[model samples]
Target: MSIGKKLANKTETVRGAAKKYLGRATGNTRLRTEGRLEQAKGNTKQAGAKAKDIFKR
Candidate 1:
């Protein structure tokens, strides 16, 4: 994956984790679910980018 994309994914993952933690602490199911979804989306994108790079080689 490109450096920019990798960095972006990592940042998103971190943000998601923080959001999830805050949601749990505050007992907000919606925020918790959204955070989990964001993290999953970031992970999926990162995986796709890595696969593309591997195929390009």
Candidate 2:
């Protein structure tokens, strides 16, 4: 995968984790769920990037 894509994917995952932690600390279920969703999205994007890289090989 490209460095840019990897960096973006990692940023999303890290942001999501931070949000999840914040939500948990604040007792906000919605925020926590959103954070989980964001993390999933990041994971999906990373997977797609990897697949694209493989195909380009």
Return the lDDT, model 1, position 26: 100
The C-alpha local distance difference test score for the whole of candidate 2 amounts to 0.90
Candidate 2 TM-score, true structure as reference: 0.85
Measured by lDDT, the strongest candidate is: 2
lDDT of 2 by residue, 1-57 (tens): 779889999899889888888899999999998899898889899889989989999
Distance from true location, Cα of 25 in model 2, Å: 2.1
lDDT of 1 by residue, 1-57 (tens): 669889999888878888888899999999998899888888888888889989999
Global lDDT of model 1: 0.87
Q: Model 1 reaches what TM-score against the true structure?
A: 0.86
Regions of candidate 2 where Cα sits further than 4 Å from its true position: none
TM-score of each: 0.86, 0.85
Clashes of each: 0, 0
